[model samples]
Target: MNNDERIHLLAKELIPLYDDLAADTRLVVEEHARTCKICNEELRRFNATFAPLAAKEEVEPNAEIKPFKKLQAFKALMVGLLFLARFLLIGLLVAAFDPAAPRLLGGNIIMFYFPLAAASLSILYFFYRKLWFWVLVLFDVFILFFLDEVIYYLLL
Candidate 1:
């Protein structure tokens, strides 16, 4: 087709054509528009049509709807507790490996205290909405049920 017909055809394909056009093709089209009246008119029309969409009004955030500082603080506290839970887990593991731990801390210490502490930590994790929280809970459950077996195998 002629120059005017070609420009009209390209104008019909507006947004998708502009978006998907190669950089070299876009530069060529821009150069062509500067010299060609039909192409220049098409370019102006395209810009004018989308100008309102491009010129977005700045939206002021609602003053009443502030960030949840309390929730963030709660999450931070939960993270701190998760670290404390890991610390307790490490201590339990160390004590389980120690041959004299039972005699020193009393026979029920390994059987009771660590598991109880782990369960409490897991309960705390229930409030936290993170993958690590679930992982920690599962790990605590494993330790609660099978830690004695692990100690037996290790001590043997």
Candidate 2:
């Protein structure tokens, strides 16, 4: 073959390394590289360029996983606390529903209602973390106390 024809054949063989050639084209290229010194040299140069990238050290993330595990543990604890608070609120409400419950220091059942309302508000505040809910709870407590005082004055 002439020099131009030989160069053309070498270029065709190198096409598989640079681009995704057909399977038959890749087989033909590999066959030519096995016999042609020029094509073999080109293939070696191309493979050498990628050799460093393929031989890099892989790093293990053993130390970084500890913090992630700690975060998961804290998340589980918060969920447990939230469920506990909900159950306590439900138990308190059920106890208050009993007709035989004793009176507090003032002999007024209204006195106990304030602490129940406060506990419910605190639970809501802890779970939601919203300033608006806290503000509304405070406003409700104020209104409740004001209404209770007015009714007491009317009864007396």
Question: TM-score: which candidate is best?
Answer: 1
Model 1 stretches astray by more than 4 angstroms: 1-70, 89-93, 96-126
**Would you list the clashing residue pairs of candidate 2?**
none
State the lDDT of candidate 2 residue by residue for 11-117, as single tens digits.
66565455356687666666777777777777677768765655564447464534577766775686566546545644464344433332221234355445655
lDDT, candidate 1, 6-85, per-residue tens:
75556445433664578876776776677677777877787788667656644565646666999879877867776776
What candidate 2 gets wrong by more than 4 Å, as runs, is 1-31, 34-42, 55-71, 100-156
Query: Residue 121: error of model 2 in Å?
Result: 22
Judged by whole-model lDDT over C-alpha atoms, candidate 2 comes out at: 0.56
Worst 10 residues of 1 by lDDT: 100-109
lDDT of 1 at 29: 72
